[model samples]
Target: MLLNQFLVLGAALFAFGVYGLLVRRNVVLILLSVELMLNAVNINLIAFESYLVSAQAVGQVFAIFVITVAAAEVGIGLAIVLMIFRNRKSANVDDLSLMRW
Candidate 1:
Protein backbone atom coordinates (compact mmCIF):
# COMPACT_ATOMS: atom_id res chain seq x y z
CA MET A 1 0.00 0.00 0.00
CA LEU A 2 2.88 2.35 0.76
CA LEU A 3 5.43 3.68 -1.70
CA ASN A 4 8.27 2.07 0.18
CA GLN A 5 6.57 -1.29 0.06
CA PHE A 6 6.12 -1.07 -3.68
CA LEU A 7 9.76 -0.08 -4.07
CA VAL A 8 10.91 -2.99 -1.95
CA LEU A 9 8.87 -5.39 -4.02
CA GLY A 10 10.30 -3.93 -7.20
CA ALA A 11 13.82 -4.20 -5.84
CA ALA A 12 13.30 -7.81 -4.89
CA LEU A 13 11.88 -8.65 -8.29
CA PHE A 14 14.77 -6.90 -10.01
CA ALA A 15 17.28 -8.77 -7.89
CA PHE A 16 15.71 -12.10 -8.77
CA GLY A 17 15.66 -11.16 -12.43
CA VAL A 18 19.34 -10.20 -12.34
CA TYR A 19 20.24 -13.46 -10.65
CA GLY A 20 18.24 -15.45 -13.17
CA LEU A 21 19.82 -13.60 -16.07
CA LEU A 22 23.29 -14.37 -14.83
CA VAL A 23 22.68 -17.98 -13.86
CA ARG A 24 20.31 -19.31 -16.51
CA ARG A 25 21.80 -20.91 -19.58
CA ASN A 26 18.66 -21.36 -21.64
CA VAL A 27 17.57 -18.60 -24.01
CA VAL A 28 13.91 -18.85 -22.93
CA LEU A 29 14.79 -18.43 -19.29
CA ILE A 30 16.93 -15.41 -20.15
CA LEU A 31 13.98 -13.87 -21.96
CA LEU A 32 11.73 -14.52 -18.97
CA SER A 33 14.28 -12.89 -16.71
CA VAL A 34 14.30 -9.82 -18.93
CA GLU A 35 10.52 -9.72 -18.74
CA LEU A 36 10.71 -9.92 -14.97
CA MET A 37 13.10 -6.98 -14.91
CA LEU A 38 10.79 -4.98 -17.09
CA ASN A 39 7.85 -5.79 -14.84
CA ALA A 40 9.84 -4.59 -11.84
CA VAL A 41 10.49 -1.31 -13.62
CA ASN A 42 6.78 -0.99 -14.36
CA ILE A 43 5.97 -1.48 -10.69
CA ASN A 44 8.42 1.26 -9.71
CA LEU A 45 7.10 3.64 -12.32
CA ILE A 46 3.45 3.17 -11.36
CA ALA A 47 4.24 3.53 -7.68
CA PHE A 48 6.17 6.75 -8.21
CA GLU A 49 3.50 8.21 -10.41
CA SER A 50 0.74 7.40 -7.99
CA TYR A 51 2.58 8.69 -4.90
CA LEU A 52 4.85 11.50 -6.12
CA VAL A 53 2.79 12.96 -8.92
CA SER A 54 -0.80 11.99 -8.60
CA ALA A 55 -2.03 14.60 -11.02
CA GLN A 56 0.17 13.55 -13.91
CA ALA A 57 -0.13 10.27 -15.79
CA VAL A 58 3.36 10.36 -17.27
CA GLY A 59 4.57 7.40 -15.25
CA GLN A 60 1.57 5.33 -16.25
CA VAL A 61 2.12 6.27 -19.87
CA PHE A 62 5.77 5.36 -19.62
CA ALA A 63 4.86 2.05 -18.00
CA ILE A 64 2.50 1.33 -20.89
CA PHE A 65 5.28 2.10 -23.35
CA VAL A 66 7.59 -0.20 -21.49
CA ILE A 67 4.98 -2.94 -21.66
CA THR A 68 4.62 -2.44 -25.38
CA VAL A 69 8.36 -2.61 -25.86
CA ALA A 70 8.57 -5.69 -23.69
CA ALA A 71 5.95 -7.43 -25.80
CA ALA A 72 7.84 -6.59 -28.99
CA GLU A 73 11.09 -7.73 -27.42
CA VAL A 74 9.56 -11.06 -26.41
CA GLY A 75 8.26 -11.61 -29.92
CA ILE A 76 11.58 -10.85 -31.54
CA GLY A 77 13.59 -12.67 -28.90
CA LEU A 78 11.51 -15.82 -29.27
CA ALA A 79 11.85 -15.66 -33.03
CA ILE A 80 15.61 -15.39 -32.72
CA VAL A 81 15.67 -18.22 -30.20
CA LEU A 82 13.67 -20.41 -32.54
CA MET A 83 16.05 -19.65 -35.36
CA ILE A 84 19.05 -20.40 -33.16
CA PHE A 85 17.52 -23.68 -32.06
CA ARG A 86 16.88 -24.64 -35.64
CA ASN A 87 20.38 -23.82 -36.81
CA ARG A 88 22.44 -24.88 -33.79
CA LYS A 89 20.22 -27.63 -32.35
CA SER A 90 20.39 -25.98 -28.95
CA ALA A 91 19.07 -22.84 -27.26
CA ASN A 92 21.71 -22.40 -24.61
CA VAL A 93 23.57 -19.12 -24.27
CA ASP A 94 26.94 -20.84 -24.76
CA ASP A 95 25.83 -22.19 -28.08
CA LEU A 96 25.17 -18.65 -29.30
CA SER A 97 28.86 -17.87 -29.02
CA LEU A 98 29.60 -20.57 -31.53
CA MET A 99 27.86 -18.41 -34.10
CA ARG A 100 30.83 -16.05 -34.06
CA TRP A 101 33.08 -18.80 -35.29
Candidate 2:
Protein backbone atom coordinates (compact mmCIF):
# COMPACT_ATOMS: atom_id res chain seq x y z
CA MET A 1 0.00 0.00 0.00
CA LEU A 2 2.65 2.48 1.00
CA LEU A 3 4.88 1.45 -1.86
CA ASN A 4 2.01 1.94 -4.28
CA GLN A 5 1.46 5.44 -2.99
CA PHE A 6 5.15 6.21 -3.26
CA LEU A 7 5.27 4.91 -6.79
CA VAL A 8 2.31 7.01 -7.78
CA LEU A 9 3.86 10.09 -6.25
CA GLY A 10 7.16 9.41 -7.96
CA ALA A 11 5.45 8.97 -11.29
CA ALA A 12 3.62 12.19 -10.87
CA LEU A 13 6.81 14.02 -9.99
CA PHE A 14 8.64 12.55 -12.96
CA ALA A 15 5.81 13.55 -15.26
CA PHE A 16 5.84 17.08 -13.99
CA GLY A 17 9.60 17.21 -14.31
CA VAL A 18 9.42 16.12 -17.91
CA TYR A 19 6.74 18.67 -18.62
CA GLY A 20 8.81 21.42 -17.07
CA LEU A 21 11.91 20.39 -18.96
CA LEU A 22 10.07 20.38 -22.26
CA VAL A 23 7.98 23.50 -21.82
CA ARG A 24 10.17 25.90 -19.90
CA ARG A 25 12.52 28.33 -21.66
CA ASN A 26 14.44 29.65 -18.69
CA VAL A 27 17.67 27.80 -17.91
CA VAL A 28 16.94 28.04 -14.21
CA LEU A 29 13.57 26.45 -14.70
CA ILE A 30 15.12 23.60 -16.64
CA LEU A 31 17.62 23.00 -13.86
CA LEU A 32 14.81 22.93 -11.34
CA SER A 33 12.93 20.43 -13.47
CA VAL A 34 15.95 18.15 -13.65
CA GLU A 35 16.28 18.40 -9.89
CA LEU A 36 12.65 17.38 -9.51
CA MET A 37 13.24 14.32 -11.66
CA LEU A 38 16.34 13.40 -9.67
CA ASN A 39 14.41 13.73 -6.41
CA ALA A 40 11.69 11.44 -7.72
CA VAL A 41 14.29 8.80 -8.59
CA ASN A 42 15.90 9.15 -5.17
CA ILE A 43 12.60 8.61 -3.43
CA ASN A 44 12.05 5.36 -5.30
CA LEU A 45 15.55 4.08 -4.58
CA ILE A 46 15.27 4.80 -0.87
CA ALA A 47 11.86 3.18 -0.69
CA PHE A 48 13.09 0.03 -2.40
CA GLU A 49 16.24 -0.09 -0.28
CA SER A 50 14.12 0.05 2.85
CA TYR A 51 11.72 -2.57 1.59
CA LEU A 52 14.51 -5.00 0.73
CA VAL A 53 16.23 -6.40 3.79
CA SER A 54 19.19 -7.65 1.77
CA ALA A 55 22.68 -6.80 2.98
CA GLN A 56 23.47 -5.24 -0.34
CA ALA A 57 23.11 -1.45 -0.18
CA VAL A 58 23.16 -1.08 -3.91
CA GLY A 59 20.10 1.09 -4.15
CA GLN A 60 21.19 3.40 -1.35
CA VAL A 61 24.66 3.77 -2.82
CA PHE A 62 23.21 4.41 -6.24
CA ALA A 63 20.87 7.02 -4.86
CA ILE A 64 23.74 8.79 -3.14
CA PHE A 65 25.83 8.66 -6.30
CA VAL A 66 22.94 10.04 -8.28
CA ILE A 67 22.66 12.91 -5.85
CA THR A 68 26.33 13.68 -6.21
CA VAL A 69 26.21 13.56 -9.98
CA ALA A 70 23.08 15.66 -10.06
CA ALA A 71 24.77 18.26 -7.90
CA ALA A 72 27.75 18.42 -10.24
CA GLU A 73 25.47 18.53 -13.28
CA VAL A 74 23.53 21.44 -11.87
CA GLY A 75 26.64 23.35 -10.93
CA ILE A 76 28.29 22.93 -14.30
CA GLY A 77 25.03 23.38 -16.19
CA LEU A 78 24.15 26.59 -14.42
CA ALA A 79 27.62 27.93 -14.97
CA ILE A 80 27.43 27.22 -18.68
CA VAL A 81 23.95 28.74 -18.85
CA LEU A 82 25.16 31.85 -17.11
CA MET A 83 28.10 32.16 -19.46
CA ILE A 84 25.88 31.72 -22.49
CA PHE A 85 23.38 34.23 -21.23
CA ARG A 86 26.16 36.67 -20.55
CA ASN A 87 27.49 36.28 -24.06
CA ARG A 88 24.15 36.18 -25.93
CA LYS A 89 21.79 37.85 -23.51
CA SER A 90 19.37 34.96 -23.79
CA ALA A 91 18.75 31.78 -21.84
CA ASN A 92 16.41 30.13 -24.27
CA VAL A 93 17.62 26.78 -25.52
CA ASP A 94 16.22 27.54 -28.95
CA ASP A 95 18.47 30.55 -29.20
CA LEU A 96 21.64 28.57 -28.55
CA SER A 97 22.01 27.34 -32.10
CA LEU A 98 24.78 29.81 -32.81
CA MET A 99 27.01 28.18 -30.22
CA ARG A 100 27.10 24.87 -32.07
CA TRP A 101 29.18 24.13 -35.14
Q: What is the C-alpha lDDT of each candidate?
A: 0.95, 0.90
Which lDDT tens digits does candidate 2 get at residues 48-96? 8877845989889999999999999999999999899999999988887
In candidate 2, how many Å is residue 39 off? Answer: 0.6
Error of 2 at 66 (Å): 0.7
- Residue pairs clashing in model 1 are none
Q: What is the C-alpha RMSD of each candidate to the true structure, in Å?
A: 1.5, 1.8
Per model, how many backbone clashes are there? 0, 0
User: What C-alpha root-mean-square deviation, in Å, does candidate 1 show against the real structure?
Assistant: 1.5
- Model 1 C-alpha lDDT per residue in residues 1-101, reported as the tens digit of each score: 78999999999999999999999999999999999999999999999998978666999999999999999999999999999899899999987785485
lDDT for residue 65 in candidate 1, whole number 0-100: 98
Each model's TM-score? 0.92, 0.89
